[model samples]
Target: MNKFNMTAIAVAVGLIFSAGMMAQTMSKDDYQAAEATIADKYKADKANCDSQSGKQQDICIAAAKSNKNVAKAELEARHEPSAKHDYDVVVAKAEADYAVASATCQNKSGNDQDVCMKEAKAVETRIKADAEAELKVLNANKTAGKEYTETGMKEKAEMTEARQEAATDKLEANYAVAKEKCDALKDDEKDSCQDAAKMKYGK
Candidate 1:
């Protein structure tokens, strides 16, 4: 196979493995075994291609090497931290802002307290949304940086998808929290909380 086809095959295999094994953590021995298996397969593929003659042989060899490189890089990337620190920082800031906002609502009374809480929640939601967006961008940039050498367009597209997935995950988490908070309130307080959630998240 040519370099492009070989690369595609390797990517397909990697993706299949990635999809089949959804476990986030693997034992050291298992990880090492998996890596060795991949390396051996790559070597064998390269050796097979080496027997061919002329331009075909050269293309096959290049393809095998490219595939091996891509696989190795992908394995490394799975272990690499992708914007985890950045996301943590964003979450921390959002939590701090939310705390401050919640506290500000504590001293007021009746409608004033309700209004204050609503305003506070609005600000908190905005901060969280902004943070989530920033984190998504950071993650995309990280992925792009990692894959730029191999395939720029493919990496960019994957990173964009990853960001969207992350955003959806965050939104679901935030929505659950909002729902719980709304559930905790009673009567008009509940109404106020729902209103605040709607105003912040959308109707």
Candidate 2:
């Protein structure tokens, strides 16, 4: 299946596992014991799968592991207050950074301003990329299939490329506007302005 489809499947698996785990209420010790058992199972499965030399075996092993990790994370989120707090903190920081970058970009002028905005967007993109990577790692740890992991990586790469292209287009448009503004200035000042714009926005 395609990367998008595989990611969807992995997410679905995670949701299902989480729901199943939540259906059972257990004491703290019981939960810990259960988690240990799951971890052992995961290790055993990984070893067995590794011993096999086939594509299907590898995929199966990966999927099983991914599902397990997802379940484990959900369990922790449900039982551990700290995990939830940490997750929230990371999300909040990312949002805050994005806002700061966007505001900074807005205060810039012409091509320079546009470049600044694009830089802000790049920061946002980086944040998103980091989140995605973390999710992917979690999924991988859970033993998500190789196909799913590979697909997620490919999708992320494509998204990054698309964002870059869009940012470049915006930069070009802003540079044109900057050039026009520069043209209205006197000779030396206009040349200097254009040079500054070019330096900020590129050729």
The best candidate by TM-score is: 1
Question: lDDT score of model 2?
Answer: 0.54
Candidate 2: tens digits of C-alpha lDDT, residues 104-196: 444457766655555544544444444444444444444534455776666656556655654665576567666766766888998999999
Off-target runs (Cα >4 Å) in candidate 1 are 1-82, 145-203
Q: State TM-scores per candidate.
A: 0.34, 0.32
Predict model 1's lDDT versus the native: 0.55
Q: How many backbone clashes does candidate 2 have?
A: 10
Q: Please give the clash total of every predicted structure, in order.
A: 0, 10
RMSD of each: 22.7, 19.1
* lDDT tens digits, residue span 1-203, model 1: 12243234323432333343342555677668869977897889888987887656655665566556555545544444234433433344344444544554555576566655654454445445544555555545665675556566666776567557655655655654575567657999999988887777665
